[model samples]
Target: GHHNVQRLSTVYTSMGMSNADRGAPLWKEKRDTWASVCDDCHSPRFARENLQAMDEACKDAGMKYTETFKVAENLMLHGMGEPMPKDLAPDWSGQHIWS
Candidate 1:
């Protein structure tokens, strides 16, 4: 799920979209797309509410991730964390013990 979210965020950023753009217009687009296929069996209100709940869950998860990452980042930045493998590069993309 993190991979999927990262991929989507990359696409959105490449399209010149900001995080703030994830509001009614984006939500309505996703809702309408799903509704076109699912509205036959599900009430629009039900689908909308479910999507809204999922959005809230995602927002909460993102906040938690930010908080956790900040702690790890601070530990590394201040040289309080475990040393990285000598063979590995300093970039985030490289394979590491945590990955």
Candidate 2:
């Protein structure tokens, strides 16, 4: 549970994993290096399985986010969101999609 919370916290504070260029050689090298480190202690198959599980978790999170965005976009397209706040600072957009 701690690892999950830590992973979520890192994801939340960072730029986010959804937009990361994971197919790049640099990313591949990094992943391979990490896998090697993991394999030093665990079996190669176990390390690979855990890494794949983490990847699946990230994909699951991304799908949930996409679904949420679709719902929000649908609400906006149908003009179903709350009215825009008029008293907010000029820099703040509040709930208005048009702002």
Candidate 3:
């Protein structure tokens, strides 16, 4: 059994937690504080709602969802310029979404 929930950074990143940033996103000890920035870095919501939103955006961007890239690549590709909700990321992922 792996117990590390208090480390919201781990739950948020979906990758694992980091104590010293370690080149990863910064995460505080409070969950409420993180709620604001969670979607920006990465999280379960990203894989869930955010990606779905990106899919729609990709379609709107006149781009097709081809089976050429991994889930991450496709999500990133589709997220570009895709109007994101203010709560999630107003203009955060736009760069990664394009690049």
Candidate 4:
């Protein structure tokens, strides 16, 4: 599932291993390993296509999340939502968020 993709994206990006990191080879290696596993049960082309579809789905999910976060941010900014608890606020300077 793409459930962990968002979190992994952040982690890998921070570690300079994300797919978006221009010179990184780790991301491609990991992707190839994943595709090989999928190929065990499906044709290589089918596995590749499915992986591409999943990537697209994750991209869509990320866009939706950004839109949702914008709404939440607006609500907070306009005083329409409850204030975030101090302990749960995102620490942007520290690049972390607490529950």
Q: Show model 1 residue runs off by greater than 4 Å.
A: 1-21, 83-99
Q: Which candidate wins on TM-score?
A: 2
Please provide, for model 3 over 1-99, each residue's C-alpha lDDT reduced to its tens digit, 9 standing for 90 to 100: 232335543433432211223223443333334444544556656535643463355444433323332454657788853545778853355323432
Point out the worst 10-residue segment of candidate 2 by lDDT: 1-10
Candidate 3 regions with alpha-carbon error over 4 angstroms: 1-43, 63-99
- Of 1 and 3, the candidate ahead on lDDT is 1
TM-score of 2: 0.60
Residue 53, candidate 2: Cα error in Å is: 0.5
Quote model 1's TM-score. 0.56
Q: Where does candidate 3 clash, by residue pair?
A: none
RMSD of each predicted structure: 7.8, 7.6, 15.2, 7.3
lDDT of 4 by residue, 1-99 (tens): 232344334433343211243225756766665566555567789867876776565556556656777899999899899977887865444422210
Give the Cα error of residue 49 in candidate 1, in Å: 0.3
lDDT of candidate 1 at residue 70, scale 0 to 100? 85
- Candidate 4 local Cα displacement, residue 42, angstroms: 2.5
Q: What is candidate 3's local distance difference test score?
A: 0.41
Q: List the candidate numbers ranked by TM-score, top first.
A: 2, 4, 1, 3
* Per-residue C-alpha lDDT of model 1 across residues 1-99, encoded as one tens digit per residue: 112233233322322212233455755565566445546666778767875675566566556756776887899999999867877635453312221
Give per-candidate clash totals.
Answer: 0, 0, 0, 0
lDDT of 2 at 88: 50
